[model samples]
Target chain A: MAGENMVGTVAIIGAGIGGIYLAAELGVAGFKLRLHDIDDARLADVRAFGGIDVEGERGGFAAVELATSDLRAAVDGADAIIIVTGGNAQAAVARSLALLLRDGQIILLVQGNTGGSLIVRRALDAAGCHADVAVAEMDNYPYSCRRLAPARIRPIVAKRWLQIAAFPGNRIAAVHQRLSPLFPQAVAAPNALYTGFTNANAMLHVANCVANAARIESGDIYKFYAEGVTPAVARLYEAINAERVAVAAALGASVPSLEEWFDRVYGVREASLVETCQRLTYNSDGPYQATGTPSSLEHKFITEDVPTGLIPMVALGAAAGVPTPAIDALVAIVRNMTGRDFAAEGRTLARLGLSGTGVAEIIRVMNEGFA
Target chain B: MAGENMVGTVAIIGAGIGGIYLAAELGVAGFKLRLHDIDDARLADVRAFGGIDVEGERGGFAAVELATSDLRAAVDGADAIIIVTGGNAQAAVARSLALLLRDGQIILLVQGNTGGSLIVRRALDAAGCHADVAVAEMDNYPYSCRRLAPARIRPIVAKRWLQIAAFPGNRIAAVHQRLSPLFPQAVAAPNALYTGFTNANAMLHVANCVANAARIESGDIYKFYAEGVTPAVARLYEAINAERVAVAAALGASVPSLEEWFDRVYGVREASLVETCQRLTYNSDGPYQATGTPSSLEHKFITEDVPTGLIPMVALGAAAGVPTPAIDALVAIVRNMTGRDFAAEGRTLARLGLSGTGVAEIIRVMNEGFA
Candidate 1:
């Protein structure tokens, strides 16, 4: 803890899966911790899980001396604020934090899917509290936690290396220094764009689950890590990866190949995306389950991945002249399968607030770090 | 009946559905009729149909003065022959006819699907027949019939138009003059390729059935005509149509739009291919039964349409700089779905024996008729 003395009280929001995991890790390492969540039951469970015993009515992790859903109370005395809310609740949480966050109090977003950091930054700007609150985003959460009960969480694999970066390049090292002690794996990405594009799991997993909706709805008997590597599925995986790479390239970031990411994350070697998915979900004793919808793949692949991930990549690919036939095909199939106008839902140059900029200008802006 | 006296003696081989219907039409029109089939029971049913009688037994139709399983006997005295056998039996039937047929006889093949005329022509060449035998093909037989019971034939809808064309070009008028009275709707197509591509039902209907196998097999009710036009299935129809159009263009023939063909064949305005199939097959009064092995659409669409119809189209489109994203997407999706390498499955240019020829050459050879 190089900054142990200087780093004051740390606030962990949501006390949900990610929040609980992070707070437990940090509390064990002797950091003064505050946890906030709307659910009191969750707070009670965290208290039982080795949190510092705090004798107060704010019954959270026994180690978390402060616990509340109040925005101001949570951020009042904090040096650092970490967000770990449900994906759907993120926008509201960001809006609330924008009003209450103080200057020089850093905001870190775990699992920053679909430009969460950028979204929160915009919220803070609208609230007139944008300066001095250095906002950063991690590609994914540092730890995997599943709920055992309403208040109980079971932490599984804590990722060994987490890529993160601040919106403004100036805050990179300072943010990393403050948060590194709480995570075993924390590294700075080039910028928010690099971190955003590297979160490939949403695109890959969602597409696979959606496309195989019939099989998934009947029963997810297949191992996603192994069977998902079938040649057909592998092509889809490649298409998705191609899109992600395109987005990263457009943003002037070097993104790793999906295959390399798979190797790093799951220890899969020479196996296709489908194979990797099948091995993990079907062959292994993992906690994955099938989607309930007939077009789950469409929902994830087309609705979520296309609108949020691939469409943005497609726009970028067009700029680069990289013929992404696989990505295009996936988009078409998902649209056909779902009968939704995904392009309308998608991130366009206009949607990404880059409307009027030429490719070069957009790339320059992205390279300069979302300022 | 103007050429009743000059009409040549006609032999219809294979007393199956097509053979029986053609024999019934021609025998009543005062042409010397001969019907032959391998199945004795089917031929017996052809005899039981009223108003026709035969003098001899080759296989079973009563209008045949002579019938025999021996091919030489059946072909010996024939002036014109119509081959109506199953596609799988094409080679054997062609060999039988070539061994015994005299020069100057006209052989009109019904349902020249999978290039049956080409197969027959190759077999005849192998048999070393060099005489001026006229080989013609009809897109499909002019009548729809089914076997109701042993020795009983059920006549359904008689197609209003039958497009016929003679290969080598010179004998077209003569073949039409001989068979015109028997078929009220006889018209001459430019060549076999025109007839092949115009039969769009084979291309679209088959793919729909195969892709929806799970729903079809599960007895989940489906109004294939009404509901199968879902955007996803419609995209598939478009993909299949694109392939057929490509093959037709390659052969220097005009391929009608699927919508246009449906109106012409089924008298339904704006009805999709699935609707046409439902109208034709699922009708209570229709000749076809509800249960049968899934038709060869699976093979045709996947094997033929993808490689022959789609791949060629994609290639041609590429050469012509036309963007056929719909066709391309379908090819990818089907390739992924079936895991079958359709490009290698006889539908591709190389497999179709058109390898090494530029686009112009392909068009010329198919238009000029098989050498």
Candidate 2:
């Protein structure tokens, strides 16, 4: 109950799957919750059911103190605000919250795709919000969830471990202390740099998606990890993963190799990456198995992962003097396939307000505000 | 006809589909033909049958003047030497013929995949051969034929037109005059540079193969041109094709685009590349439809095309100062997937003995031999 008193009143932005599940779990844990979403029909559905009926892995008829579309009312006096919107909408949410956030409020991104917190921090500064707020981000969402209805959430699986870090990184300990009660499996990372580099979706999705683009477009129904990731495709995954590891090391963060990460998370240790992915197909109970193959090249696997995931890694690699030919090649192929310029639209060092900064200075800026 | 006295004797090298097809067509046309193949079993099969049974498009039972494994005996006193071994075996065939070849003999490569003539000429020099010889190449093989058995050949579909050019631009008309009696559809180009730039396999195979790699590895049985070239994949094809066109333009060679080439060759006038490929599947008679999907990553679609096809184009691109990001990206992905250094192993200016030469000089060398 370390955070029971400190994080008493919490606001959950985005009434999507992650937000709804968080509302039900926090409500059943005896904490006050307010939920907000821009979609009026969604809010209406939630109001009709009174609150979320949390199911799967945890059971409860949890109630929320308030449900509205108003940003100000949702975070008026809340001690913490958790954003569950995907990376595509994170910046806009941060911009909208710039004028409404209060002092001592904490904002945690459920999953900070590479440099998520840095993006929000920049957006808040651009909007001229002077609130003394701490921004934290997790490496990935802690739950694989679905909204059965607007007011019903089924958390398929809760991850065994989660990595969380705060902007400037100096306030990670205090932030971790307050968020531990909400996510018992959460562990403190040195900074958002570590959490951002720990993003697995970037390394796993784009190459496999592009490699299987025709299979997806032709409406082939097959297991994404088991069948889509062939031996050669798996080798490509390893090649890109090596570039990601080198970028993280150049930025003073040491993360596990993709194999080690898969071993730790899915517990599928095999001789090669292809075998590991095949074993993950049948072994990792529900998370990867439930992941549907993208029907088109426009799926989040490429549209979201390429710009937000691979683009940022390429930018960071350029900043740290690490050559990322494999990553750059993936980005180029995606751009050619989609006819979109992901590099220009992606989150680069300039977007993160760290353009032209050296490795040491970039690390310092990541741990300390630009001011 | 006209070439009956000018080209009375022909030497057909290799016992593969192309070589066997060439032997039957020439023998039936009333020319003496000598067939050579290193494989004794293949030559034995030919001797057992006493000739080639040409089936499909052209039907005939034709006899050869001599069938031998010895290189010297095959080309001795022959007016024309046609090398039908694929691009992979062309250099060795050229080296073996260097000392054995007589003065004023013409050597025609059925399908000189990018820079085929240059490779053969270089191999000839390295072997210390001093002989008066004229080297020529064709844009592509003339027929989509297969060997039904050791001595049985099926010419599925013969191309409507064939482009041929000699090593030195001054000798193309003479070479075309002597070869026209055997191939009435033959057209003369400026030099090997023009014929080499017209190679279509390099522009078609590698990108589509890489895009549909997973399907190929998973043993998916689908029409390669129709099912494999989806909309997104077709866009990638166009992107890489543009680089090839630009490289040709930089070298002062005006070539038709991939779409236009298909229109001229297949008579399929579709709006987009995807539709053209789809139409080609059903409308191109038997060539594209009969093309099977690759069964493995090691198939010649990649192993041969990437090295002999795209690699040479990439090297030419660098010499011409054209940026081939899309082509380079495809090369990088294939290299990463297969863990092979295609750039170093492929045809380059250095391999052609034209390193540091400008676009104009490279073109000059392609037209005029080093002498």
Candidate 3:
């Protein structure tokens, strides 16, 4: 309503679980949609089939008018481009999207960690795409879906209160006014920083995986959350949450209690962190269990979470003179587990244009944005 | 033989699994022994049964002679007092032993941490028990066994090359000479610091427990070591080993590779850590698994290891200007799971009498045993 702009044509990049699910929703909603992915076979299958078969929750087969591997075909004439991929995959998408990004286009990164928006912006600028795009990031994806097949997704759980924020806090209204049609549940967060620290994916996934390393390695079939979130583990989860909140406070951001966030998103109202974890852990029939546990720590729990989720927190905390002992400790252990220097390789405070910046400066930069 | 004196009478404190096991081993060796524990019921059972029922590799029932709860009577005429309780329980034993300790008494702290010798020595000094005692500690116990009943122990595996070091490095030969009948395979370690850092129980137990937290919490019974020792976890073990070795090097002590130690203790000849873990883990019915995984993180793996094993490593590493990031990280995660400040609560550099001491001074203190 603010801009009187209807984002009719949207490009959904990355044919992963999130990508396919988003495309199905938009395609079913009667929006002109283009789906792009690096996988050639997947694109061909979707094109040959005329659309993806979306099942579960609200089931349907929605026609994707354009399904292509070509960047230009996907982005041309598109008002908005949503990158539904892991933080690691985002850079490659940004690298390719830079060449075809159009002026006034809106780019939204789902579950972007700190500096995620900045990295894409830099890539676009470096590629000479001088598109005056409104780049935004959500704290998490709106749906928990898994790929039933290459051209199909089973929508497991549709989450609520998804938090999205444009890179420059000022552009949030315009971005929200346009994309709200697709994501009606998403509310505008304060800024990119707010969404970055608000992410709970890494906090929940990493420790559970690490603690359950033996079980996962043994090739035992079991629900990940319901059984995994024991009272003891829930206690550990609280400590990590406290560290994250402290990091946010150091950067002049107030994060909602993880318990509160869990209740809001997953609908558990337990006051005790352990009790909440215990309740949700064994809900094997729930949306989270559909994905199953990763067979190895080499999966996203260590790979994506460590770099995107944890590294940024540590870097931000260090830049602001905060002692994130617990976060720092987990990072140290994980680096050895994966043999990767996440601090050097992941999204960092310096990359977020926040190095040497204090709380007030970080807040100011987040509001104004770098790109 | 420095003293040319045999330790005629020995006092075995703590009627727990290890204490009883040691008393059984020593009692079978035809040495005059007295067993003490806080639990009178356990002591009475051992006394009422006449001796502990030892069944396993070398099965036999040995008379315990006398078992009592009276600490004074247990220590009055003992030439040697052996404390075989956990790292955490060692302090209280030292506190009680301070009052009864006399000259020419050799106190052996089996598997005592770096602080073990120092704490007892300090307590004795404070109590004006100016006894010329040679306090020593073994890197680990000589055998892997558990108390099947209050008066029955089922030995799982008997290990060799038990590393023993007295508080004073010069006293190593003397201590070994005196206790050779009890531990024939024992060798002189560099010092108490060497034995302390060489402890691999926590390193193996903590990571495995933490990694397998989900499985343990779910009430699913599974083998801990063999099944728990996955490829990803093996990598973490190596990282922890590296940090520990780094700390050791900083303190001018050379530590063994965890792989070599496992091979030596468990007789697994696999070169790779993962392979070794796989080989050792499933021996579920074997000696190592006899200890089994704790039902919760509240067990010694977190409580004692974080403070005694990990915290001290980090503290010593910091004192010697070495970075123990991996050890620190695991400690952080475990602390949250258990909700205890291991660094403050457990054996620390300060508790070990090396708080402000530098590398040279620490080495010096190790050579010239305190008290």
TM-score of each: 0.63, 0.94, 0.93
TM-score of chain A of 1: 0.79
Q: TM-score for model 2?
A: 0.94
Q: Please give fnat for model 2.
A: 0.85
Model 3 DockQ class: medium
* Residues B1-371 of candidate 1: C-alpha lDDT, one tens digit per residue: 34433446788888765676677656655767667777666556445453243222222333556555556666776777888874545656777677677766878777665455555677777776776677777776576555455434455556666678766444577777776765668787766667766654455644454344334333444444443334446555666576667656755677676766655655544345545555656665442333343332244334544554455455545543456666666666566545565545433444345556665665555556554
| Rank by lDDT (best first) | 2, 3, 1
lDDT, model 1 = 0.60
How many backbone overlaps does candidate 3 show? 13
- Which residue runs does candidate 3 get wrong by more than 4 Å? A1-4, A55-58, A146-156, A277-286, B1-4, B56-58, B146-148, B281-286
- What value of lDDT does candidate 3 attain over all alpha carbons? 0.78
Q: lDDT tens digits, residues A185-219, model 3?
A: 88888787778888878678777777676777777
List DockQ for all candidates: 0.16, 0.82, 0.73
On the 0 to 100 scale, the lDDT of residue B266 in model 3 is: 76
Alpha-carbon runs more than 4 Å astray in model 1: A1-101, A105-129, A140-162, A168-170, A180-183, A201-229, A239-254, A270-274, A287-298, A354-364, B1-231, B234-300, B312-323, B332-371
lDDT of 2: 0.83
Error at B51, model 3, angstroms: 0.4
Report every candidate's CA lDDT: 0.60, 0.83, 0.78
Q: Rank the candidates by TM-score, best first.
A: 2, 3, 1
* Model 2 lDDT, residue B97, Cα: 92
Strongest candidate by lDDT: 2
